[model samples]
Target: MVDELQDSVPLLVFLGVLSASYVDHVALRRHRRQILHLQVLEYYTRPGDLILFNGRAKVSALQRSLTRAEWDHVAIVVPSRDGGHLQLLEVTGDGVTLSPLTSRLLAYSTFHVRYFALRKLRTPLLSRAVVNDLLERFTAEVEGLSYGLSLRRLLHARQTEPALSRDSTFFCSELVAHAYKALGLISSSSEANDFWPGSFSPGDFVDAELGRHGASLSPEIIIDCKLLEVATATKRSPST
Candidate 1:
């Protein structure tokens, strides 16, 4: 059964993030709500329709809302970061079911933008064959260490060395290409020199299309991954 199911059409899952540093916690929460609402209104309706969320709490709420609206397939997007050992959870009208985590780990691991891109690119290779190949190659590349150890070492090296980082980015892009290829989607990892043109600064504002799968899929949405941090200090009265 598992082998037969593995031959099905590949699911293309793209993960991206809006940085918490660029948007405050309050604003980020609100933005998430608005985005989910828009998605529900735009694409999901009736039973068996899927609405995916990275967070479990959000998934629960979505499940209730969708059930109230008569939707069935309330799929939650839980990227398994801890290798392939841990099972991912999926909730629906029939209650929660456990499945092998296939999505990229970045979905829940961190709020970093680059991690999001890398993870998204890695999702299409979740099949047993591709995953086994990736595991073997990754192991071969970083011999002697446990899988977790090797992954940590790779991540650290990518962070500490500029050349390694660049190579890692290229590797991530290649993975994304492979994912798209598996799913039969056209993909281009074009680099942008400047997110905004002219004298525009950080908060100036602009809209960019991140990527798109096809005519049937909704356009990939990209918004500024910025967050603002504020600090306040209390004043002390002068001594008499």
Candidate 2:
């Protein structure tokens, strides 16, 4: 019996370790899966909403340090008409293009993400159809444009320039700025006359100006798998 107990101790220890490891992996994968599921769901994010990222890059680090912003990059949410999936219109080193929202979120899930924010524009001002129309116009206009490569130009863009139209190349913020500008959301009336991409950073979405009053924008918290909140809400919804 003594010999049998001694042999069983090693087996028990191994099983305990294996069980603990399985639990840990399950919890971690659960979180990753939740984020993925929510990010891919349709109507989880509306069109024209902006998902901002506090990325890890040399330029992003420099911009964050200099501008006192938690985020350095931004992408525009584009909800599909079929209500099946979503896409993002973004300008990265790969240039301006449309990417699936699920893939984009999955790519970032593994990063040591510093911060994320979802800024949803107030309704009525820019309805769903209006936002879609503006995006279509932009897609047509910037067909062959490359990503903005000139830091000097990006850092120095001024809305006060004689020409109000943005340059051919675009940065992430530039694409967002142009979309809102085309919708007349950030016009002189809103005190957002600075539609220049260089003049705005990803953090500027926090307090967007609308006409005479400054709209206090609150973003959806995007860490700790909180993105699943969208999915949870959907599952509990009577509409769904």
Model 2: worst 10 consecutive residues (lDDT sum): 17-26
lDDT score of residue 36 within candidate 2: 17
lDDT of 2 at 93: 76
Candidate 1: which stretches are off by over 4 Å?
A: 1-30, 34-170, 187-240
The runs of at least 3 residues in candidate 2 whose Cα sits more than 4 Å from the true structure, single-residue gaps closed, are 1-41, 80-84, 153-167, 188-208, 211-216, 223-240
Positional deviation of residue 25's Cα in model 2 after best superposition, in angstroms: 19
How high a TM-score does candidate 2 get?
Answer: 0.62
Per-residue lDDT over 22-132 for candidate 1, one digit per residue giving the tens place of the 0 to 100 score: 222432443321111121121122111123332335543353353242121212222233443333333222223334432222233234122111011223324544544
Per-model C-alpha lDDT, please? 0.26, 0.53
lDDT comparing candidate 2 with the true structure: 0.53
